[model samples]
Target: MTLEPDLRDDLLAAVPSLRAFAISLSGHVDRADDLVQDTLLRALSNLHRFERGTNLNAWLFTILRNLFHSQYRKRRREVEDPDGSYASRLTVQPEQGARLDFEDFRTALSTLPHDQREALLLIGASGFSYEEAAVICGCAVGTIKSRVNRARSRLSSILKVDATEAIGSDPVIRAALHTAR
Candidate 1:
């Protein structure tokens, strides 16, 4: 059932904080906004199921969190363009150098063990605190830190990443390298 007018208005008012939380979770503003929109739509559709007098903020967050995890899982099975052959064909000449670095970074990222990769992405890319990531990953904070550390070490080893070098200029690689150091 659709949300009543009053409930919809309340949801609209919560957009800003919801967007901020989404950005924190997703890192990219674009992806976070998309998640917020999806969350709003889901909340509206499921309004009938929402219990009255409950915490709307918590409800919306739960919806967004569930959506992010679902999308994350879906992306895990999708093939990535490691060589940038597909992306390269669509980019202009000037941007191709950056694109190549991105491809190498992607290749190096894929080499890490899945747990480490998850920890790294959660803290480095997604901006989650170690404790928050541990909560999400169902592990202790120390475990999350250890996983991220191992992931960073493995990535540095695999890519021979130098903090002062050209590869470090790439933001994605730089974030990992920066945090590792």
Candidate 2:
């Protein structure tokens, strides 16, 4: 399929940002890159259906996000890797407390409702304004804000971190927890 030069250029320009968004959504670099590749292929195949003047970035993002969710649902039934088998094979240093904290945070994050998690990530991690998130989520700005608030509150509860208390003494982690509260 031949894409117009301008359209091809625009799509190429969006790749890095799309991969970053995918990583934020998937939390796995390899999976994120694969998702990005799949998204691009789908976009190219559906190029004829795209409206010339529409927001291409938003369209691409919507496709990538939906793909992630669909894949996530399918992965739910898959078996996990054997516990220490995967971890023990990796060389670890004695001073890797930060990794443990990250694991805890990731666990807590995965517990949040999908809406809240997406809203929180779009605003907090992806640097999207509430309005932009609203547009992307196909909802009101107030709805996006509410989701982010609820997500943060739920995470704080799940992690058992008080607004004034710190997690792992890491300022970045502490600020994230505090801000959510």
Per-prediction TM-score? 0.45, 0.45
Q: Give me the overall lDDT of model 2.
A: 0.84
lDDT scores of the candidates, listed in order: 0.83, 0.84
The residue-by-residue lDDT of candidate 2 on 6-121, one tens digit each, is 99999999999999999999999999999999999999888888899999999999999999999999999665676767666777545467667768888998888899888888
Candidate 2: stretches off by over 4 Å: 81-181
Q: Model 1 over residues 76-103: C-alpha lDDT tens digits? A: 8886899988777774446667788778
